[model samples]
Target: MISRGSIVVMAIGGALLIISIAHHSQEWMRVASRLGPIISVILDGGLAISLISAGWWLRKQQTTLTPDE
Candidate 1:
């Protein structure tokens, strides 16, 4: 079964992914560019993917550990 915490994490990741995509607009891109490529890559890609992967891994672990009924 999926846990609430995992769900919340996935939700947050999804939000971040949306924000990252939106941030690519002309205005937001200008701001992000000024922040430098390293920070941009970490914030707009790594963090969101990490959160989503973590949530998915958590759910997978829980399901696998549960005994068959």
Candidate 2:
């Protein structure tokens, strides 16, 4: 079974990935650039990797979940 913390982390990572992609694709930087697009790309990639890793870890722990063993 997956831990609650993993679920929350996955959710957060997913949101971050979405936001990063949106910011990267948007041309708002040309109008009024603040943080630049590079940061978004980096963040998006990082978040996606983290989410995948967490999911893998959760899957690996699936057989260890039990109340009374």
Candidate 3:
């Protein structure tokens, strides 16, 4: 069982991991001109997801109420 916040975090992290691994494949290999654009996309996508999820989680935590009863 996953909460919405957990799912959001997981999805963001998963996309980043998959693409980050893919984007870095060439760093350990021979450099190719075609790889630059792909890496940028991967980086951007990862950054976006990470930022959005973090923001959402922060907001949720801030808004949650504690039981006083």
lDDT for each of the candidates?
0.76, 0.71, 0.64
Specify the highest-lDDT model's number.
1
TM per model? 0.67, 0.54, 0.41
Candidate 3 stretches greater than 4 Å from native: 1-33, 67-69
lDDT of 2 by residue, 1-69 (tens): 556776776777778788777877674456476465666687676878688678667756765777776
**Which candidate do you rate higher for lDDT, 1 or 2?**
1
> What residue pairs clash in candidate 2, if any at all?
none
TM-score of 2: 0.54
**Candidate 2 lowest-lDDT run of ten:** 27-36
Q: Candidate 2: RMSD over Cα atoms?
A: 4.0
RMSD of each: 3.5, 4.0, 5.1
